[model samples]
Target: MTQKLAGRTAVVVGGGQTPGATVGNGRAAALTYAREGADVLVVDRDLDSAEETAELIRKEGGTSLAHRADITVEADCESIAGAALDTYGRIDILHNNVGIVPAGRTEDLAAETWRRGFEINLTGMWLTCKAVLPHMRHRGSGTIVNISSMAGLLAGGETIAYNTSKAAVHSLTRSLAIEYAPHGVRVNCIAPGMMDTPMGVDANARAGGVSRDDVAAQRAAMVPMRRQGSGWDVARAALFLASDESAFITGVVLAVDGGFSLRAGIQ
Candidate 1:
């Protein structure tokens, strides 16, 4: 009901909503962290969108700042982390929510598109972690929550590039967890299933070749809950990882799907 991450500083990469009613996972996670008493840093490629999320947090009486950076680039990642450290003095949580799902099969996808998917979805997390881990390790405590997807755990048809990138993130999470556990840094990942976010809708629109509503319905039907998940579902799980509530948890890929990962088939 109240602050679980008080006095913590959280950085949420890709915290920006696209042009629509739906908020992105990063935006929701940033707000949730703020509401739980963490000073939030909302990072995105688009300055305006990141600022919009930061404004929302400020409006809710939470401390927040916005930083625009291309997460795919090492220099940008370093600058963003530097700014956060300058502003907040320390970092307690790093949430990697940057991802892009380009629609393509292995052969049909252009080399550039495939590279871009890996650049943002996989390499971006690596860069952010690289930039933040030193500071975290120096402080002797931190939590890193990387947002992977169900596509990583299971096959995502026709989106080989995106799927592979997410799978790589899962591997990265495990590697970091094992290496950093002795230093008191917890590394984990969230593999969200089909969620009702703008990015999810865009991914469905591009890959499924149908209206967003139809895609939503089809995804809901695949879930045992008879409904799709919301951004808050992932956000809440992230909060647990970011807070001390999950102190013993590390190297875990928590699936925030609506029982979709559990069932064999609807039958």
Candidate 2:
């Protein structure tokens, strides 16, 4: 079933390569949006990785442009949104996927580390939304999908900073949704569980303090589905939020976890 996001334009932040996966969430979402007929703006801190994603989209006969900008920087966020508007003439969807999961407890995390987490995960989203709001308001319609994590909903034992930052994103999504709904703009968030993406693998490895496969197995064991999710899993969820199919859905925190969020502590 093709999601008809045709003729619309989408901007996916953090579209770059992680440790294990060839493509990250931003890359997957960009390709999916393009496949569905939306022009894509693939943004990442690494220009090379973003270009790679854009090249794949172009090879697939889809329109995509790569933009390198550090979302943690307010100026970069403004420039990115401005560039998208200048190139595309409008911004219909903004997919905020910037996040970093440094493994540590609150005591173990340095103040700088904690601040960095907020800078990239929560503040970046806010900056991007601020930069794009005027253009979206002028158009009188827009959709914003912020990528949170199950860690946002539940306590993440090791990554306190990451958890807190994501939780902020969830709240931010709701606030933006309510405030902008009257303007025909919708905002929502997807909180995904353990996904087997590059970032997931790296996070697992760090948390486990072991080989990548060991981390993967540990993650799979925790999930009821007996496996981790893929980038495409979250990509599909983003597509739903970006498309008109979810025209009435706003301020929703859709968990893309495969029953992991539902499982009780095993006996």
Question: How does each model score on TM-score?
Answer: 0.95, 0.94
- Candidate 2 lDDT, tens digit per residue, 69-115? 98778899999888898888889999988888766887788899888
Model 2 misplaced stretches (Cα beyond 4 Å): 1-3, 206-209, 264-267
Backbone clashes for every candidate come to 0, 0
List of clashing residue pairs for candidate 2: none
Model 1 regions more than 4 Å off: 206-210, 264-267
Model 1 scores a TM of 0.95
lDDT string for model 1 (1-267, tens) is: 489989999999989877645777888899999999999999999999999999999999999999999987899999988999999999999999988877777778899998888888988899999999999999999999999998887776688888888989999999999999999999999999879998887565765678888877888898889998989999999999988889999999999998887884422
Question: What would the C-alpha RMSD of candidate 1 be, to one decimal place?
Answer: 2.1
Q: What is the C-alpha RMSD of each candidate to the true structure, in Å?
A: 2.1, 2.3
